[model samples]
Target: MNLRRLTYLGIAVCIASVPVLAVPAQPRSVEYRSPVDLVLLKNDTWLVVANQTSNSVSLLETKSGKILDEILCGDHPSAIVACLDGQHILVSCAHSGQISLIQVEGGKLNEIHTIDVGFEPTGLTVAPNGKTAYVGLVATGEVAELDLVQAKVARKFSVGAWPRYLTVSPNGERLAVGCSGESKIVIVDLIQGEIAYSSKLSGGINIGHLQCSADGKYVYFPWMIYRSNPINRDNIRRGWVLGSRIGRVRLDKQEYREAITLDVPGMAVADPHGIVMDSSNKRLVVSAAGSHDLLVYRRDDLPWEGVGGPGDLIDPKLMQDRDLFQRIDLGGRPMGIAMARDGRTVYVANYLKDAIQVVNIEDRSILRDIPLGQRPRPSQVRHGEELFYDARRSLDQWYSCHTCHYNGGVNSKAMDTWNDGSALTMKTVLPLEHLDRTGPWTWHGWQEDLHDAMHKSFTTTMQGRPASPREADAILAYLKTDRSPPNPFREKDGSLNESAIRGQKVFAGTEANCISCHNGPHFTDGEIHDVGLGSEEDEYQGYNTPSLTGIYRKVRFLHDGRAGSLEEVLSDYHSPEEVSGTRAMTESELADLISYLKSL
Candidate 1:
């Protein structure tokens, strides 16, 4: 058998023979369209997809699934929605912090205007009147309302941390925003122009897209629940460690919330995203991105009212009924879903395959996969990306690396993986961006070799077969491509503010002594220290010094996620007085220090 060797970040990796694509001498004008979301337009005759990676929108013929034209838009187009007029489309470009207004005429997409909203404009929804639009800004934790008539942002509403998805009521009286970082649904009363209430999910994390019922009575979403139990085979097989759920809550009140487990004994649905309901509201379809399948359920037949216990949410008997539930396996990672007027026909944005999959919900069969365009040959990084998002790598297809480290970022939850010779010791997930620079792996700083760490994560943490040497190399190559998003707190030119500049001196000063541990290119000394936050159950003596890069993106602070904010971390836990034996930081100093950290 032939073998190949590749070096990534100075680490030599040997792998099985695989064809490597050569880079073009000159940069290509067109890029790969990694479609993330789509919407039907013009009486379902055309489809528009938000090409996430390409930063463009692709207009396609619905019947033939042929690309009519690709219109360039803002950066990182995350979501798309058609307006009430059916001729205008709204796409939220996350990274660029702008909304691209597209006009559809003669089966072609034209970018009419680009409105600067704010940072990380993701989830988008248009009101019934089509005069107003709501977008969720992830970095700032707020939702901006766009006045479509003026093609500008009218006002913004503070919802919560990491507002990733939003859905407006049929009557346009309320908006349900999915705040993924906080694991809650914030209801914004549009008439009153304020937040009515927020329904918190006890153990929910990675909240998926939100959808409102046609009648405007309830909102539905898919999310994952992490059970704080010891990581073991029995607990994992029984769905106690990490599980998937579809939750429902009434728009009128805060107390009427219900959830049903999508996992059944051995078989589990992981990373449930992109949900849709039939016209009659009888069928509910969800794309299980991690599991690489679609779960179709008879919504009326589901026992959503007081079904199961705490750890076990699903009734075992429900799994035996095929009429109530059916799983349709799609090869690529299925994301956003769009239903045609003929409710039985559902279109899905297949992320990994770079195509739009048309499926018939009635027969639970795939009609066809419409490739967006010609894709480049498979490279090592692309191959690793598939494996990273592929849940089949786990036992029974429960979860994938994307489940915890979402989009190569943190999941805002503490998980016990039994990595450090102890059980039930939960540690907050560390972001994977610039992962190579932040090693020695694990919270305990025990794993010295990155290759061995990746192997252990698959075999022990996922409770699945260990990845081969070649597979590990591919995964590492993919990680190299994962870079941290631009910090929104910084200035437009990426310069630090006055407060951050002042705080930088304080960080290096002996009074704070932060630079002693967190001083490097990635803002970490790459060493372990005893900060006195350990517990009796902890097997490790000290925790690893975490990198402060993109620290503002995190919702929870500290190793165990005890601190809810940077202020809490400085005041309540891990204070300068406690860590460095210096005097407590004053409120003014703390504010400046936090500002500097966020600027990083």
Candidate 2:
């Protein structure tokens, strides 16, 4: 089936499955206090959940519901996977690009070894035989394997774009890696160390987390398609920041097939956050970050029916009264998931909830909820060296200017919603890499100097202290290395979309006249234009065209986010109402121009 049809079918099943019940929300207990990742161990008696934000792990007594111990790790600890014996833990610290080994014996944890990896090791898994542990480097397209026996590096292999989470098959012959950048899956033959197979999905970008069915017949990974349409320079800016879907691939085959994929049913595909498999009873659990709900799919039937038959999956007849087995409400935003050995329970890590959610698998019931930390964002590792401990910012509480503008690209989609939102308008967050080279801050090009803009924006908008002369210098030091997130959407063979190719012709041609300013890798000529489009609030009629690197992550266009879509902007030049004084263009030309802008 086509991706659109598959998406609808999955949503239809979910919608049909709902049965009304007067179920009361469960009470909150066993606050995580900083829970990151969880693993079942010691014959299912103990559960170790990574408290990465707080640099520790919470040991839990599963049967007794008791907190056993809180073992500390150094710096930013992220993912955690257990050894085959379940007596040790491997965690990655992306901040320092290091992986840490923590030995667990007799209910206590001890530091073992620290091995340095590449940029941002976010996902990890131990081989079935407990001989090798694979680590996914988020920023680098590579996987690093650590030898379990010696607790040292075994080997590393290059893979597809921005590998996030990885999984090993039960027999230990095959390994699957998920790439967020290219929206593809690469399966490697462990013995031969060669990529045995690969599956590419359309609308598949930013793919996260891979899960293998208990029988090892099916492999599942969450696929997200960023909305891509290039109609105008403005719409190209909006890009595909928001996405949707839960996708599965057949592993036995050498080629990838789109099987049993589900859309973000009741909600806009904000982010398909997490995936976990309950091996005991054949349950597939997915956490939808947009809806903040845990979705359950049962494998008793073919194509893994949802709650109801086909259309009933959304509101499954079998799950109407099964609160514990269907959907569970996480108090806040849910991001990650892990299952217990027996499949009787599943653990959820909430990014915004600041806690870990424990759910009973059989009845779809939430058995316990534990509070873990503040602002947990899918951590997977712990490093041995204290590299980040003495950094400028303290461990407990210090948010960097870069925190908001990740990798200098403003990776997030949040708007400046402060009361004085006008001053901190869309133009305020202009890219800094090309500054000095690119004049002014904000769309209006109001502040000419870099120092003034930083001081005013940080103090007024961020509610941050106005940096002292020395402090401002330090902040500027951090801002100077501003580089945009790399573009993975460009075709693999280096071919541009046909429409985008046409659009490119029109862009530089006189018909569009867009190339007068927007050009280069940054996609901006660092020049301002009147274009005859501005509001009364546009104190300055002209604005600097911002860089296009990762423009898909941006939400607004122009100085005030006035343009809603790229198509609107391209078509606006023709609309007397919106375009006002700009030159008019035909609809076909507009579409072609939009296709071109998107190629960028």
Candidate 3:
């Protein structure tokens, strides 16, 4: 069979064929201004947006709402931050693993420097003195501190797993890093250059942008809490299964954290991304990316601690108070927010609409929608991408498909979505990179029909209205476009290293015997086997052989996430002696084998 290579976010993978409706591809010249993050630069006169898909940055005049200029940068620019000097801004190019520093010179953006940081640089922040900057390296699980003057990485310190965002305290003494994979907030003492506190968020996932208080007392962010209960209507309605929250971590102390539930009886917030506070600190705004709205809250009036007593996450009386909180609906997905100095006007990076919405908090209305630039016409794949991220598709607008499979990738947690025949059977979220080629969906290899599986996800797992046939086809089209990121373990020319090359021999040899069930280009035979890893609660006795293509991206392994590392998966649970009835590999052999697996 012939194969075609697909590349997204710098990662390339081979697929046998397109499985869904073939949408027309856009021209390479047409810019898709998927504005993910933005910041107010040049003293609020200019709004700078990080156009993710376009691989550029757009500088817009705040007053006239005109696109001043679009400057090309590194690939997949994810976040932008204005420097304290008011003349330069930094953009974190995620796919390129580089930070582009641009100077704001007389209404024009000039690329000054490109600092090669590390893999997946997502969040960025500058210190009070503007001398140093911090970047959250997602894949490396470390925070890289850059010396602004030197234009190079000064040092790196490990925070936690997948640090997606970072915030610096007002005093510039502490930097709070949000580690989404581990669901922990690591506070780095800038003065001492070490981790001061590591506050774990129980059941937290998808931790969003972080904003430190003016007084340097707390760091606030938006995140989702997963309750591993059966996917039933009662649990979903009561916000017991999956819910949203705005969490805070005390910077002055260790392991001190608190959160307020953003969900009410009927209405709930989902995929809360960007968060900001005004200069006066009276208003707090959070962009609900999944729900496509801006949640504005009165900062002082929020019931944080004394509302319903100890261990109370939500207060009914406070939730019913409309004056305390207001939701302003914006049609497109909102990822980042920039508050004006006036404290009422807010700018939102609307991803789907390819525009920035200027919202008025006092009147609770969208004042204007500033178009970033011209984009391609909407296709079935585009609509499918919208549906995949829209939380309104779920019951009570609680979660979207992206809530679990983040950006068509996997979340670090195993969830009991109840898609299988049994309940309470937690399974790791499988990545949708090559979903079209990987037939027989689900862990048990039970979902033979892809369209039926999509319908069941909406109807059963999400407990929402079943998708129409057309909608399902659109989703499938979007999934076909999804691809895994470039494996960092691979060489620059995409060749295996010496260790991996040696390990590849062992994999094909009988000692490891890994190629027996996993013997395809995608590394899966598409067959189910009794791996002896199933629990008694599992309805299905055998498990499907999963593809090991992007196994390096996964922090948790196995069907139920029991194996924390690839070494654990090979040495402890599914060892050669246990599965293939062979002798255990030596430590050197195991190390080489892991290196080879990561290269895939």
Candidate 4:
């Protein structure tokens, strides 16, 4: 009961509320279309959208919005779950790694099987007796499972480095997944298929869509914070980088607490790209997708509970605001969320208004919205086929490193401060289709390559100014052949991550030593470590030790946001000695050394 008296008794039970700042329910001009992901089959009366760049999967009928069948496939489909008794489906194509299986019967969609397995498959679930299906693959961190009575592949496991979402718990044994290029979640152990546990939903930033609840206890996730500062002035090249919240993570005792967190005062836009769990009205649905909206929380208003330890969730008044959820203006950009039989009605898939919005979790309402096509984006294909992209080169509206690394950025906070010698603020963005084998770019390594780090991040930090230089070589040829977005927490092949195995025994032991330099596989051993917060006499004295991959969508800590959080970047700037490599520990061992640098 001590750790500062349980952090003053969990901030006096989370400062008794007082954190509401939402306001953006007045722009209703809805024509709808942008369905990224949704599925509420059968009981909710069918809704299935996975339309990424319009390859197609429509089929909505939830009480008359019509469009009861679009069913095309391949070119892009991107993730969908349900199976057999629910009417068999399983789609995941995202630029063709393929995995269709459709078989709806009476209400259309009968395409049976397609199976390919490794290049894009971008996450899809169905193994709770639905006859095994997993998928994920995304540039191979691996997962594939499948064998729905011999549909194919049946086994393959790896787990980390870029999984987007998996979930199969409600007594299905286990299989958590969620890993957007390193920062941990990887549970896996479904009847010993492997990886028996690991957690740290990137409190540093960049972890997305992990959802689970039909009685699995709790697991919802979708965080992204990508900060950047550069020299602030309400955005020098882009830094605020908001939205995307809902951490939760409890699986009996896997831990990592402080459930909900997303405030939207004035214009912060909750962001959150997808999360689902209506579980018949306990409610959780959140695809806050950059403030276009569709959020809702309930679950007795989630906040710190048993799984609350790492800096034990410093009470920022329990976050959650995008106007207290229950709002639906499905005009465009609403990532994903799914539920059917008894979750009290749910379904949303509106990536830039391709359409599919049938919510109504007990009057928080929206109920009918079914349009689909022309540059939409959702996939989990199965025999339909016809996805093409050209919404003016969709990076959502181009120039997107997700605006400044949002969704795939984990959970951001802010602070770019011009560059390296400034200190460091979640400075990693790796995951580039296996990142040309991790080369030299920012954080002091400074770009000596990758086309001069894509001409200083596409002409001075993504300004683009009418791009040129061949549209930055077609956006670095589409970020080196995109498709690495599905890692669903890879691990089922040997495990590790009990606070990173007690944070690698205290990050290489000796109270907070931090392995002297951080180590490899992108955890960073690139060098440079001064710590005294730089600028003693400049000339790059030290700092460049970035790359924790998706460092929990970093927002601000040093390099200029000057430690706004992450337990104040380790209990007020690395405590141990004074030389300043910053890591002496204390404060519950710096939340187990940041839960072991987020289990990377």
Candidate 5:
């Protein structure tokens, strides 16, 4: 369902099926164009895609890339999944905070039910039994467990902040939720309904799409590697600096060993997003969203070569038999990659272009340039969006704005932007939303206005030529529309729950004494505070009081990426400015406090 909807018409590719890894007679590439997630329906009969920008769901014939129907849905659809029954498609809309159950009867799609799950539903997965669906509630830091048969939310349980994606074990005994906000994955014991384990990955590890090995021994995900506390663009200029790594964590233990990596001395991959492995586990496919390419790897062909620096995710072997079989050009912003059940083709969702690029996996060529729908006309917002994802503007076409922001959101990594006119004092990348009011920009609060920051970001951070004032205006225009998503914990009537209501008292109360600095429409005063958090090595002691409006989406917090969770921010590293007795608060009280903070 994460794949997007189509327009009235679609572009068809070849209908011929190719066995796994077959080389097609023809070699070509094309894109239809658009957003969010891509999911191949059961039996390879239909391709269901979620379009966040278009507010619709697209269904297409498995073969020939033919459009079946496009169903209108709620706002900002995030994730989609085909039910175990093979007759239902679940679509999660972030802004609408609801799940639409599209019933597939007689090969036609129908919107059968719309159930309110929670706010900012970004990720989804279904239980093997086909009776349950787990949705990641981004705004509330919880997972709403829905009974598929009942078609209602059964319950909700707390997870890490901004849980973005879900992957279930083959045996159905364990579940891995990609905790994007925490830069880790929380494994839940399904039977026990408790956290079984957590893989605390390194910084900038935005586990975009997670897939369990066939044996379920490891969880494979695409990760960003920028190990130094503050990233060094010098390394990036050399090409080996930042790595888009494909990593595997042993489900049984904690380790950061690399099975594959997408960076080397030159021609680094930009943004690696959608990831999928064939049912045979023989092939691995990754969608490099920023670079607009699909890189396929043969598991048996993994090169023994090892790479070092900024933490090598390289295969440790010295031999250079690259496991990668082919790197096909997708020619658009590819978001999600979904493999068909027949193992012949992979469907790609190009987030910005409003089309799906179907690739013949065996031939290693794009067979069709299918358009689900036509994107809107020219506008400042759309132009800015194009500019944001345009890697051509970067030095040697290495990256784009989307490479760092990952669709206007944080990559959860500290950056050595060199904007401070200092070295090694890297600042974490800030969210682009509500920037008009969240200034002064940057962790150091150096730029009072965004206009000044744009020049610095281009010349200093990107290591490229300065952007024109007109170009900067267009980028800001698109960014201005990036407001905070709805809070999932709030009721339909816009009232907080009893626990959150009580927790609000702790937040604003004299006991906590937090309002003087955190007050205002966005829950921030737009000023700096020392908060007793300064280290001798730090350049400046005081840090900006950032808006809490979208705190739930943060992977790390504080001046640097120190606190991984709100609990850690409040209790383990409670600052002098925080509430009294926070460290000694009861578990129930902590939950209430967190609930209230997440609501904001």
Candidate 6:
């Protein structure tokens, strides 16, 4: 028999042998009172850290190592940037979908205004003149230009899905945005009103918190290796996955397209974030979020460079000797980072521990821990989110749930975990949203309970301890609260537009019937169907129908990521009926249908 027949036979035999009630219950839950970004005051006296988990920003006195204040803000404050005025700060609150512009006068802050941007506004970059600011909207794949003069969003420009970080050129004319959701960087020309470049990166996932060089010559970010060829997890011990890396993009006219990759061969410095370079631009301080450690490396210290050059190289094994690498343990999940003017002290936002650990770059040692003033122990959702971003729960502190989810979202990469007894079969990272309403977890519909999936992830994927009963409840609470972000296709009145309404009728029709499988409030019928789509390594007779509420947010489509766009979703990969229906659909009608689906 062929592979398809074998797959059907295997599922039939397995179904006949096991019953639904036989599946065991598993406990789990997930948190970052997650500090996603930070900035230093112009005077350099205090550093402000955005606590996405706490909905607060903590001010730390650098000299005294004291928490001067923890000012309450909107929900999920992800990014903070110090404007040129020295008294103004722009903070992006992700959960609230607003950018709060706070004015600091004398010694206090004045809430100037909160401009409602869109869903999941992440990184922001202020112009040197402080006249304009650009905010990255993660969900809508657009960047909003905020005019500080008017205290409002001026214009929004499309970039890519999940524009996580924004870095402005020194001249303030060019903007480089790290589109993490799509694993690419989009360079926008501010004056011309167009994208100058959209460079696809290698092994860059959840790429955020970018820092430009002093001369504005390049941008550096921490990324991970997911393997190029289709491969199994068996080679994980051989560095096939969970590999450490630092990527650099040269922007000079001579080397505008040049890319550089650096790594310490065989080292387990996973989940790189919070990177800062010293004044001389030699010493580099990077927070390995997954390992709970800070890596200190000097560019000159690399042994690859010959006598007298910058050693422009791309060797992954230049720093193989462990003793040659200067590393420090932060003992917590570090996310945001800020460096002193002189570059002697580096401040780190320890998201999980609620403290700011200051590291002296000179000796690579922890100078002090400035408490953000810990609140009560994390509640269920809070605890769950912290657990979600934390790597300590994994074996040897290898990586955290954020390694795959990015920020309770998809990683835009595929992996073969052998979870379903399949080898050399890759599955795209499914998004975690509208979990409570969407029943039967995973694409195969193996785990009926979300908590059970969490337990399996911890025990199997992370190779760590199974989730406790309480932990499971906390994680589930977080999943429920982590609703799908507001889709951008809604009308001004928050109702379906005429095109979408028309397309809705088309969707319910028998020829282009989408409601049969994608039905109800969550847009899923909670059923599996053969649908004539199966591969050789697929162990299931059918695939679980997924929710389409935030379908526009996905960079790839289907379980194996065969479709790269929404238009492709209606193309050859679709079932015969859908293909025929879509083929007969007029270009305008097809556009309307797509617009309608995205509005969900």
Identify the leading candidate in terms of lDDT. 3
How many backbone clashes are present in model 3?
0
lDDT for residue 273 in candidate 4, whole number 0-100: 67
Is candidate 3 or 5 superior in TM-score?
A: 3
lDDT of 3 by residue, 510-553 (tens): 99999999888898999999978889998888988999987877
Q: Against the true structure, what is each candidate's TM-score?
A: 0.93, 0.58, 0.93, 0.32, 0.83, 0.84
Minimum summed lDDT over a 10-residue window in model 2 is located at 1-10
* Candidate 3 stretches greater than 4 Å from native: 1-30, 306-314
- The predicted structure with the larger lDDT, 1 or 5, is 1
Q: Write the per-residue lDDT of candidate 2 for residues 15-79, one digit (tens) a residue.
A: 11234332121211222244556777787787777665555566667787566555445455667
> CA lDDT, every prediction?
0.84, 0.57, 0.85, 0.56, 0.71, 0.70
Question: Looking at model 3, which ten-residue stretch has the lowest summed lDDT?
Answer: 1-10
Residue 325, model 6: Cα distance from true site in angstroms? 3.4
Residue 363 in candidate 4, Cα distance off native in Å: 42
In model 5, the worst 10-residue window by lDDT is 22-31
- Which candidate model has the greater TM-score, 2 or 4? 2
Clashes of each: 0, 50, 0, 86, 24, 12
Candidate 4 whole-model C-alpha lDDT, 0 to 1? 0.56
For 18-95, candidate 5 gives per-residue lDDT tens digits of 332322212111222256686776577678888777677777776777767765677788888888577888988888
RMSD, one per candidate, in order: 7.6, 17.0, 6.3, 21.4, 7.9, 12.4
Candidate 1 local lDDT, 94-163, one digit each (tens): 8767888888888656666779875788899989898899999898899999998889889999999999
Model 5 — TM-score against the truth? 0.83
lDDT of 1: 0.84
